[model samples]
Target: MSLPRNLCHGTLDEIVERGGLTEVTGADGGPYLELVSSAFPGGQAPVGEARVFTGDSIAKVVYVGLAVPQIGLDSHMVFAFCPADVAVPHFTLDSVQGQGTYAFHLDLIPRADLGTHLPYLDWAHTPLDATYEEVESRPGLMKTAIGPRQFAMMSPWMLVHRAEDEAFRGISDAVKAYLDHWFSLVEAGVPAEVVADVADTDLAARDARNRTNVFSPDVDKVWAQVERLIGHEQTEAVRGLLLDNCPPEVSA
Candidate 1:
């Protein structure tokens, strides 16, 4: 399938322009990024390997790749981790398009109770209200496709949908708006001393949430194919790099 060009890379470039980022290498001995995957036929290598970006207020890792025409796989992921003590939400965006359909999930995942935090919720969600309203008004567009297990990790502002061309542009616009909002929150994040006191608790909670939501049963489906292409050891390494979030060998 012919997908949108530079959609994910271009967005990341905008974020990079907002602040300086230090590059981190991956286990593959290359830049901690993969431009494309060579594991499958016609995979076209990912836009690049997974890249990690860190700044004062936030740290992010992103991966963008075209579909494996052989198995119908195409997707991009962005996972941004904020200072633990900041009390702000973490950002998660996953976009998958293939087989004549698309699934997009974007959220400012709450670290604690969203219901009790009206001010933060309002600040985070109000910007996308119009976009949400438009999406909800459409038929068969808005969805709860994240599955029940991952629902608790999402905020009320979460956008999960099966988008069509009519709704795609609006969704994309909302993504950009949300990204800007998240960057602002990162810039105005809590002090480092506060983060130091709560770093352990915060990171533990984030890791637990990621283990539940980011590492899904569905991932095994993809891994089945990956193992066949790359073999067991390489597949395990890739899975660890992509889904584990905080590997034990590395300090958080």
Candidate 2:
């Protein structure tokens, strides 16, 4: 299998602008953000977008348009919020979903395939939210509020404008598809491959996710679990690499 790849902000920005926004709106009917459209459009080409806060905890979104030279287009980004503590009354953990964002960052995935992302956030994941999906009824670009999440998992608006080449789009699409399918599978209680396909270039990024990405953390702990997992290989010299990079305590 081809080694896992880490995508950059620059590549995604070009393609999305080329693909253009299919639709935009606020999912599940809230005033926090908006969704753009491309899912099932009137035209043969497909597109889609939705924007919301990064999570319920904060109002400001992370920086966007990283792919683009100037910044994102004149639109606010959508964020997949996971609230550790549930909000009160109005949106309950069970009733209305006041806690988590109930979101998934779909990189290389196509707009039409959004349905594929749903399973991971379904009833079983409940307070896990993945609930309250809404979008704009028209055409426009969109973005996600990412907090050191998988580079592919996010759909930053600027990335839409930046990913101009076919290769970049192909890669971006591939990553997005992987994330959607992977996240959905995990939500379904299936085994998840949240491990990173690492390299020297992305060493810092990989470490960042291990540090803050909600889904996964700590290379040694994660690797220990993987080692305990059924019949795995120690390719890429990861064990040695971790020893060289991590603190002695973590390495031990």
Candidate that scores best on lDDT? 1
The stretch of ten residues in a row with the least summed lDDT in candidate 1 is 243-252
Could you tell me the lDDT of residue 115 within candidate 2?
34
Index of the highest-TM-score prediction: 1
* lDDT per residue (tens digit) for residues 1-252 in model 2: 111112422223322333232222234443222222222234222111222122222211211110111212121122222122211101100000012111113322111112334432232223322211211111232333434434433222113222213322343343343334333432343323211111112333433343243223242233443233211342112232221122111211
CA shift of 134, model 2, Å: 32
**Candidate 1: which stretches are off by over 4 Å?**
1-5, 26-30, 33-48, 64-66, 138-144, 190-213, 216-239, 242-252
Task: Give candidate 1's whole-model lDDT.
Answer: 0.59
Q: On residues 63-162, what C-alpha lDDT tens digit does candidate 1 reach at each position?
A: 4344455566566666666554455567767676667677777778766554654555565556668766766687647584545545665676788787
- Every candidate's lDDT: 0.59, 0.24
